[model samples]
Target: MSSVESVEEFRAEFRGWLRAHLTGGFADLRGRGGPGREHEAFAGRLAWERHMAEHGWTCVGWPVEYGGRGASTAQQIAFHEEYALADAPARVNHIGEQLLGPTLIAHGTDEQKRRFLPPVRAVEELWCQGYSEPDAGSDLAGVRTRAALRDGRWTVDGQKTWTSLAHEAQWCFVLARTTPGSRRHAGLSYLLVPMDQPGVQVRPITQLTGTSEFNEVFFDGARTDAAHVVGAPGDGWAVAMATLGYERGVSTLGQQVGFRRELEALAALARANGALADPLIADRLTRAWTGLQAMRAAALRPGTAPSTAKLYWARWHRDLGELAMDVCGAASLTAAGVHGDPYEPDDWQRLFLFSRADTLYAGSDEIQRNIVAERILGLPKEVRA
Candidate 1:
């Protein structure tokens, strides 16, 4: 079959599988978990993901040698788009399957890949990122998390804030200073640390959504095997940046699918509630639709910088949240309590509150602008104190 034919076939297969399986026990799980709603049906979502893994659906993008199907980029995109269209529960292993797994494939030792990839492919172990300390958030070079090599083990001591899913994760990929006096991204190492150890403590942070998807992780002399390091001791800055590249990669196509859904639903809502009659609201809705089209084009265009795409989508989503509240008018102020909990927000309210952080997380709007300015536009670097 031609490549186009193959992609279509793959899309059909995935769509078919979702239709057949997302019923009976899993019927209610549709749209159960994502963003601010990560607290919803946690056990059910995990179980559904594991069920997908059992049927060879988890890490489709990894090389076949590492237990993936060795799927091509087009095929992987098809999988994600179809998965989103099916409204499959938000994936539980995204950090493992998308970020750390690919990082290991690129920079990890043979032994490291052998030890970690299988559990990730099977969803038997969940992973979280250990970047973004309280002081170091987007300025990763200022990381004070220190790890010392001693007697075949690395002892780590530091705190990581805004660690998504840390409370539910079994492992974390940590970037820490390895040399005593090293500064500004020097002498850093990326270590794979277990989250279950006595020295590790995970405290969940309740957010505007009234849920605890992000966490504060404290590591006091946590230990990982010396072999857990991904690359050479001082090369962590490079490896960490690579992981961020993957963060802004093809999987974002899947994210855009979700964005399209939100836009469509919001439009329907406007029509039903008479918001569409307001000329300004109607104009903003039209602009959002056009922006989604541009975002999708940018995602597919070759030579498009990730920073540029990140800046656009983050701002667009944040603006969409603001528009969602405006569409709701005065009613957005009060919680509808559609869910059992009185404090539980309806979808639009939740979207508005949760997306307020869109511009802040995943490297922040200011940081992304700096990257595009300095690297892509070839502008002079910003002065630092």
Candidate 2:
């Protein structure tokens, strides 16, 4: 007999636990000097993530059968809203819980689930998506990465660009073409590739902020068992599309809430400093808030329209970046690890720099709008090519 409470009640119970376990907020100054700073920041983020995992809030949306508390969507949303309201630090294992876990759950075999799910929940295995090759950003069908099976094993060889956190991750969920001479979307496959193996190289790409947050991953003769293949061979597009839908639907909820809260803080800073007397500053703040709210509502939709909120985030966050600099002036533009003003948080700066990817990742904004047109508006494709 399942005796779970209502969504409100569940949130209440979860909130009580959070009040007890989750400690601290954005007091992080990115630690000190060189490697030490990164290690400290990573440790803090990991601790914050561990705190969430220990209390079962990390995977609150997952069912009890998969090591979660079986929280409802309302409960999940409420949990996130409150967490962001309280300014919880970013989770180190977000990619695992948000993108990869759900994809594997839906498309992975029983053996895959048995091998993957527990470690993911426990934070033992860190996962990163290996999509968006240099030539294959918006046009995923153009993935040139090759993964051929011989001697009952997959031998992969190719380069992946803009691969975020590949250096920090232990495994990557990769999409590669298995059938040669099959161009475009055909004969592609998704495989859970282990990165710790030989012939896998990761080189970090320094961003505008000079932070090495993304990587260019090259795989040469990367070997994996046939068991690593997810779903059917050459069905990578279907799995990838489904994963993108989940990301747009569920993952964006937390992000938008966080952005909304950050915008509120931005507004408060404006109010505190008498900056809002300037109409431009006030307007930017208002627009940022409204955009985040609209995104929140759209994120709550049942079925995803190919339109997608991630595209909206990139545009909104980029706009907010310019506005943040406008409002923050010289303070926000400086390098991180320096403590001075509350309003000029580096996370925002990191987000702002990374926000460059907002419209880029999870299908570019133009692609998403095109999806809305073709799928939702029943419009025809414009490109004759």
Q: What range of 10 consecutive residues in model 2 has the weakest lDDT sum? A: 29-38
TM-score of each: 0.98, 0.88
Q: Give a tens-digit lDDT track for model 1, residues 142-174.
A: 999999999999999999999999999999999
lDDT of 1 at 122: 91
Model 1 residue 374 lDDT? 96
**lDDT scores of the candidates, listed in order:** 0.92, 0.75
Question: Judged by lDDT, which candidate is best?
Answer: 1
lDDT of 2 by residue, 294-367 (tens): 87677777764646555667788778767766666676666656466443337556556656656776688777
lDDT of 1: 0.92
* RMSD to true structure for each model, in Å: 1.4, 3.9
